[model samples]
Structures are given as C-alpha cells and as structure tokens.
Target: MTQTDWPSKVTARVADALRARRKELGLSAQDVTDACAALGYPIPRTVIANLESGRRASVDVAELLVLAEVLGVPPITMLFPLGTAPTIEVLPGREVSMWDAVAWVTGESREEAMKTPTQTVLNMFREHGILVSVAMLSRELGEEKRREAALARDPEHRAKFLDMVAELDRIHARDIQSLRNWRARMRELEVVPPALPDEFAYLESSETAQ
Candidate 1:
C-alpha cells in the first residue's frame, strides 16, 4: 500500500501498542489480516504492515474495533496502554487526564497508576518466578532514583542507594532482557512490509499492494 500521511504521536503510540500486542499473541501480519477478513473487515496484510511501520497514519473507528477484536484487547487499550495517563478534555469547562480519573475510580493516588506497569508486563512477569508486578518493580526503581538524586544531601544513604540498585538489578533482570528482545523484534518488523503470501498474492498485482 502507498504510504499515508506523516504519522502523529498518537498514531505512533497506537502502532507501538498494536505491534506489542501482536507479538504477545504471536500473531503475524498475515494472521491478523486473515482474522480481519473472517470478521468481514478485510484488512489487507500490507495495511497492517504499513500501520505497524508508521507508514499508515490515521485509523478509523471501524478498523480500530476490528483490530482490537483480532488482538483480543479493548479498543482503547490498543490506542494506548491503560495506565498511560493521557490527557483528555471531557467537557467545555471540565478536563481530566486519564491519571486523575483512574485514581478516582480505583481510590488510589495518581502515583500508583504511574508506577504500575501495564497488564501485559505483569502477565509476563507472572510467567517467570514470582508474580512480581510492574508496580512492585517500579516502586523499587522509583525509590532508588529518588534517593540517588538526594545522595549529595546525605552521603550516608549512598550505601542504601547502591543496595537498592543491586536489588532492582537482581529482580528485574529478566524483565529488562525481555524488553530488549521486544524492541529488537519491533525494529526488525519496521523494515519493508513482507511480500504477500502465495494465497494472498492474487489479491494484489501492483507495486504497492494491500
């Protein structure tokens, strides 16, 4: 497919979120496109490739809905992770960012949501040793950073700061490695879209096909 308009930050975030979900589900571009077709949405594999590569910018509501269905996530979660704290204008005189509303809904401080990892990462960690949530790791990291910044004020806590760092390093080694692998895979997928599979080749007979 021909490239669409230059992508925006929102579209970029959506693309990252979509690619992340697809990888989590072990679904290829062809698998996603076929699922859309089964749902009667008929999303071509090139369209998915373009979207993931940020070559396709805007996504209409129908496409978004079908994509969410295929990926098995709520539609908004596909646009942005739930704890992202994205700002929004609710009404003419009132506005609330996601952080505020979520805090209110959950009866927790905004910091909690900010520190909490997305459900995806939490699930990943659950597959490993303990069910250590992202929030747990984030809290440790956040405290360490905060203490590290104040180290000049109290050099006595330097040892504690180092201890925190070591603890975090030990606890999050797998998560960090997994994140690195995920980013590398994303880079690989950002290359030119894959050629249509044999069954799909007949559907497109042009240089730019979808």
Candidate 2:
C-alpha cells in the first residue's frame, strides 16, 4: 500500500511506541521539544504531543532519526516494534510467520521460541537460570547494528568500522572460549555435595531394615 493509503493502525502503533518510550524515560513533552531544538530540528512541544496522540499521521525520516537519537533508541524501534511476527513468503504457495520459524530454529532444548514475550521470558529464565537481562543484550545488539549501518554509509569511516568489527569479533571469540573452559572446569568438579551424616545413617538403617 502507498504511504498515504496506510491504515490508521500503522500510525497508531508508531504513536503508541513513541508515547510509551517517552513515558518510560520520564521525558515530558517539553523535554522532547528542547531535545529537538538542541538537535537543530526544533520540533515544538505541540508537535510532539500531536505525534504521540496520533494527530500527526506521518513523520519525516530526518525528524524520526533525530528523535530516535535524542531518545536513545534506533529509529525503526520508534516506527515499528521488533516483537511483532514478520510475514515471510517461503514459496509461491506457502507462507511462514517469523515467530514459527524462530520456534523451529530454537527446537525444544534449553531454549525455545523467542517470538512472544511469555515464551522469550520463559526461555531466558530456563537457559540462564534467571532472566540474565537478555532483553538488554538484544537492545545492545540492535544499537551495534544501527551504528554499523550508519558507519557503512560513510566511505571515509567504513575501513575503521571494519577494523573495529574485527576486534569485536576477536574479543567475542575469546570470551566464548573462556566461558567454555569455565564450564568444562565446573563439570570436572563434582557438583553433588557429600550426603549429610543423618541422611547417611537413614540410608544405612533403611538398608538394614530391608
């Protein structure tokens, strides 16, 4: 559909996301207005209020980018949420939702599907023995991708970005190796503690009774 032909739901979702983030950051309408001014965009407080209330149907790319930067989030995050299931056409006659594909990819191991909030939270708790801030990790990765994309757009910065990415990869590899070694060491040490004296005597008494 053309941009003008887009449904109100589309605009509403964007509005909801922006409003939620603003509230989450404890930013008032005036705060957003002042931030926009500092960024040289100079969006009025009334404009921000209109955007959050869905009175503004469309936001220009430049404004959205500046707003996202000021709000400490990637631009697409304010436009569309990552939690929604994406529609993928696998074949001419077949289609699969992104969520279903993620579930299939994850299998029924320590982790499962990460498509829905409930499933993602459950999997995080299961795999990490607690949540372990997986959501924060996802946000960090998202920001990294955003920065990489921004750097890729600049010919002068691409080489430096490549070197930085290479160093990041090396660090990640070392961290992974260290984690594996730690796990191996933990496995080598017996995890089961010695039985208590009372439990041992109980077992002996049960054996004798038998």
Candidate 3:
C-alpha cells in the first residue's frame, strides 16, 4: 500500500471492526445511531451504514470515540483489532504485531530500557499509587486483626491473631518506606510527586518535622 493509502486502510479496518462488534452485540445501525445520540454525539444511522458499507472513506475522531463507547469497546480495539488480526499496518510500510502497535499507541514500552523519561515517570507514579493502596489495606487488616484478638476467648486463637497483626504491621511499614523512596526518586527527577493520601500523610509530616 502506498503511504497515502494508509489513512483509508485504517478507516476501513475500523469500519469493519465496528460492524463486527455491533453485530456481535445484536445491535443494528439504527441502534448505534440512537446510542450515539444518547451520548450527545448524534451520529446518523445513514452515516453508520455508509461507514460499514465502505461508502464512507473517512471517520471523524469524535465519531470513533462515540462509536467505541456505544459498542462497549475501547477506541484502540477498533483501530488495532487485536486477536482478530495478528498484525496491523501502523504506518504505510511499517506493519507490526497488533500488540506492539497497541503498545506504541499507548506510549507503553515492552522493555523497561526502551521507556522514555515521561513513561518512566508515569510508571513510577503508578507503582507509588499501588504502594499507597497496599499500605492502606495492610493498616486496615492490622486493625481488624487486633480487634479480633481482643475479642478472642481462646488464648491460642488470640495469640495467632496478634501474630497476624504483627505481620501486617511489618507489611505496612515496608510499603510506607517504598512509597517514600519512590517520592524521593521523583524529586531526583525534578518532578513533584503527588501528595500522599490521608492514610500516609504522617510520612510527609514526619519528614517535614525532621
């Protein structure tokens, strides 16, 4: 395909995927039109039919977003059609695996070494969020275990509950330290990390005090 043909090829691929997904969901072209209207985009039934029949050679970005929402699929899925297609012509002459195309489109690198500085920062913040959630869950679990220990009539059961609480405490402390270290790395990158959640507000307060 010529470089100029890539645009039409992409549009045709998306159109075919849209038709397939709509049929799989037992929706007619009119159904899609109504759904788009409900979403405030108001794509006409004739437009949907034209797109599916290849009478239309182009799709607007707004139409693509609305259609994907109406079809209950990610917008990228319509563009890339992974699983159904092994590879996609991401460019005129650059055909790659559907998964690789997806990774490129989403700004995700399969190899950590290939990640850009922005991707690294995004991943660091994502990891930091997970650590925050783990720390919060551990703190809650510890409190629940402590309460169970207090209510236990059997001395052995109470001891076991207390041990679990201790383990949870260790987990929470480890997560907190990991979060602090992540924030430190963000600072080193000259990027201001997001403020910690209330459950971890003490980490910042203590650091300020020191």
Candidate 4:
C-alpha cells in the first residue's frame, strides 16, 4: 500500500491555478519562461514546469508575490480558490479590518478580488496589550510563526493564534477610525495633517468599500 504524501493546502492550490492559467492562455512552459525573461526575471523553463507540477515544495513570500504578479493571478488565489471566501471564525465583540471582512466575503465566494484601506489607524487601549505600530504588528506576525511551531508540537497551543489574530484585528479597526477621526481632532489640536493643510478640503472615501 502506498501511503499518501500530501502537500500543504496552499501549495496544492497554487499549483492547480498555475496549471489552469497556463492552459487558459494556451501557453507552454517555454512560453512562460520567455515571457519571464522579457519581464526581467529570466527563470528557466524547467523551473516553471516544476512549479506547475507541484514539485516545488516551498516558495518564499517574495517569490510567490512575483509569480502572482507575473501570472496575472492575485496572490490569494495561490492560497485558495477565489470563487468562495474562506470561513472567518470571528470571536464575538471585536472590530475586524473592513478589508479583512471583505476578504473573508470574497474568499467565501472564491472570487479574485481585493479591498484596500485609504488609511488604517491602530489603537492600543492598554499597556502591554496593544501592538504599538504597524511595525509592531509585523513583528508579532513573525513571532506567531515561532508560536505556530510551538503549537504544532502541542495541539493545545494552536488556539492562541486565532485569539491573537482577533486581538490584533481589533487594534487595526481602532487605527482605521483613528485615521478618519484625526482630521476632526486636528482642528482642536491646532495642527493639520500634512497630506492636506486645509482639512476636509479634500477627502474622498474608497467607493469600492465603506
């Protein structure tokens, strides 16, 4: 009996999309290699073929980002099919990023789409509780990988990631409101946002999202 050797879900999804996209464009492995050369990446045809075949087990974030940009596929498509949104298991009583909510919806529908904030402002309501900045958030995400490794070793540790994401998301929501509210508050402070000296003179919300 042959035991199944399963790839990571993300890798499998990416491989499927690569194959589908190549077929849809009627492009061969050599064609992709040539296009990549023109675009200045110049990856070999065998590399393209290997990735498409799921023989490439790992890709760094930068490489994946470049591949998505080159292939005309959104980065998330390589993680999961875009037609249905992934289930967002939100803990009660927390504000999630509007973009993340939209992402979850898009994932459920599995559509290739994105939403971006005009600006995101974050708040840390308590000492030792708030990630101080976006820089801090990035650091926390990095730390979470270490946490994830620990969790992998102990099944009980995994739930912490979900909780951490929820907490971080709340801080991000506060930040979004912070950016929006800054204009009104700046007048009180006798200061103006550098982007616009004449406050409320030029404010246009993203029409694609609320």
Candidate 5:
C-alpha cells in the first residue's frame, strides 16, 4: 500500500522521525536532499515537505537506514524508535512484542532457561519498572522455600534445579486466557499474591563477580 493508504501513526511517526533526524544531524532539508542523492534516493525538499506534513507515509527499511547513516543515527531510530520507543523496554532484549519472551524459553532444558536471570529481571521491569530493586525479589524469594529449592551447584542438584525450573517455565508461559483463569481461581480461593521465585532474584555476591 502507498503512504496515503497507511495508518495515521505511520505518518506521524515518520514525520517525527525525520524531523528529529534533521535536528540531530544539524541538517537542513537541503542537506537531506544531498544525502539522499549520494545514496541514490534523492528525496526533494517538496517531497520532504509532504512527508513531514503527513501527506505521504512510509519509507523502506533500507532507505530509512541510508537516511539515518547520512544523518548520523542508528537505522531503527530513523523510523521505528530507539531506547525510548513504545514497546521496547517492556519486551526483553528490546524486542517489538511480548511473544519474544516465549520464543526465548522454547525447547530449552529447564535448567538453562531458569538461568536466564536477565529474563526474570526483565519481567520485574515490566511488572514494576526498570529500576525495581533486587531487595524486592530477595524478600519474596526468602518466603517461598518449598517453591524454591536451595541455590546449589552439585551436578546432581542441577537436575533437581531443572525440575523446579520446569514448573516455573510453565507458569510464565501461560497465555492471556490462562492468566485470567488463574486470577479468577485465586479470587475464588481468596489467596494472597504469590511470592516471586528465588533463583529468579539477584546474583549472590559470588555470582555477581563473574
């Protein structure tokens, strides 16, 4: 579909991106014209005017990258977004969607998957905020001894660790309807909020040094 056929946000996002690029690069609209020429795209001032005013929308990824390179920014920042983009921080590794969390855990042995302290940290960030403290996780974990076997390192213990991890992996993998079911069940049972798992908490001082 043409720019004229795209979503309104696409047009607004495009305009905001280009306007920001121009400001950051210290470029006039004419400078974009020169850079576009060097890249063989050659967007004219009037074309830019239309784009910035939302009369047309959408630019190709490669074209966006070429403009970003000429304008001196990352390609994503040119059209999608950067660190502050809407869906970035809530998604692990700054992905575009929540499903990325599932993909990361798929088919992995429970032991390896639980070891992703990063994913757990990201969950905390999503539920709370990026700055959620380790102390919060620590307190919750300390209260759930049965759910969280000791953090051990014997090779034999690793198997047990993985078994515990499998249960957790299942919980986090719940789809929206499953989560809704769980919430309803909890309400019916009048259960308190469950504790966060251990091993999901911060590294011990020893773990941190590594």
Candidate 6:
C-alpha cells in the first residue's frame, strides 16, 4: 500500500481490536458510551458503533484513551494488539514486530542508537527510585524483626529472633550502601537526586558528618 493509505490501515486495525475487546468483555455500544460518560468524556453510542463498523475514518485521541480505560487495556495494547497481530506497519512500507512498534512508540526501544541522553537520565532516575524502595522495605523489615526479638518470652526463641534481626540489619545496611552509591552516580551526572525519606535521613546526615 502507498504511504497515503497507511493512516486508514492503522485506523482499521484499531477499529477491529476495539470491536474484539468489547465483544470479549460482553459490552454493547451503549455500555461503552455510558462508561465514557462516567469518565467525564461523553462519546455517543453512535460514534462508538461507527468506529467499530469502519464507518468512522479517524479515532480521536481523547476517545481512544477513554475507550481503552473502559475496555480494561493499556492504550498501547489497543493500538498494537501484540499477541493477535505479530507485526504492524509502524511506518509506510516498514513493517516491524509488534513489540518493536510498542517500544518505539514508548521511547523504550533497546537500540543504543535510538536512545538519547535525556532518555538515559530518565532511566537512571527510574532505577534509583527502585533502589530507594528496596532500601526502605529492608529497613522496615529490620525494625519489625527487632520488635519481635524484644517481645519473645522464650530465651531460645529470643536468641533466634535476635539472629534474624541481625541478618535483616545486614540486608538493610547493604541496601543503604547501594542507595548511597546510586545517589553518588546521580550527582556525578550533575543531577540532584530526590531527598530521602525520614527513615533514611541519616544517609544524608552521615555524608555531611563525613
């Protein structure tokens, strides 16, 4: 097909996926319309019907977002339908795997050449946030173990609980070190990392003391 025809083909693909998903969920056109209304964006039943039947030539961005929410699928899943369609013409005369299409659209493609410095920094911050969560959880777990050890009546049980607490403390310490290292890298990149939570405030204080 010519480049000019690609837009219509994309609309057709999305239309078919929407029809299949609505049917799979046993929802009628009116049901979708009601859902859109509930979401504060009213899409008429006739509009939904027209889109599904290929009577509508284009899908509005707002309509697509609301419909995807009502259909209980990611917006990208509605457009790509990965499992059902193995590949898509992401561009005119350029067919690629459905997964690649998704990655390109989301700016998360694995190709190094496709990655910009801004994307790299975003990814770094994302990873750092995950490490911070892990460290927070580890610290909380250690606190729980300490409390359990204190409440144990039997000496043997208390000893076992104390051992567990020690292990948890070791884990928390390791996690905290990891967070410190991650923050250091962020600073090296000339990016100011987000402030640590109250529980982790000592990390910053310790650095200041050093």
Best by lDDT: 3
Candidate 6 regions off by >4 Å? Answer: 136-154, 173-210
* Candidate 5 structure quality by residue, lDDT tens digits, 1-210: 343343555456657888877887788888888888888877777877777777765666666666677777665444445444434332223444323323343322244546565554444334332112333333343344324455565657766766656654454434323433443444455443233335333322323354
Angstrom error of the Cα, residue 41, model 4: value is 1.9
Q: What TM-score would every model get versus the actual structure?
A: 0.40, 0.40, 0.72, 0.40, 0.37, 0.73
Q: Can you tell me which runs of candidate 3 are displaced by over 4 Å?
A: 110-115, 129-133, 136-155, 180-210
The global C-alpha lDDT for each of the candidates, from Candidate 1 onward, is 0.61, 0.58, 0.88, 0.54, 0.53, 0.87
Question: Model 3 misses residue 194 by how many Å?
Answer: 6.6
Q: Tens digit of lDDT per residue, candidate 1, span 1-210?
A: 112322354566667887998999999999999999999989899989998998987777898889999988877665545676576332233446855544443434354444444443433433332322442465468566656856646666766676666667665665545444443443354422233335334323543452
| Highest TM-score model number | 6
Which residue pairs show backbone clashes in model 2? none
| Candidate 5 TM-score over all chains jointly | 0.37
The order by descending lDDT is 3, 6, 1, 2, 4, 5
lDDT of 4 at 79: 58
List of clashing residue pairs for candidate 3 = none
Instruction: Identify the superior model by lDDT, candidate 3 or candidate 6.
Output: 3
Cα lDDT of model 2 by residue, 116-174, tens digit: 65554444335432212333343355458548857596875766766665666565555
Instruction: Tell me the deviation in Å of residue 205 in model 2.
Output: 81
Candidate 2: lDDT over CA atoms?
0.58
Q: 36, model 3: CA deviation in Å?
A: 3.0
Model 4, stretches more than 4 Å misplaced? 1-7, 84-210
Tens-digit lDDT track of model 3 for 18-73: 99999999999999999999999999989999999999989989999999999999
Name the regions of candidate 2 deviating beyond 4 angstroms: 1-7, 84-210
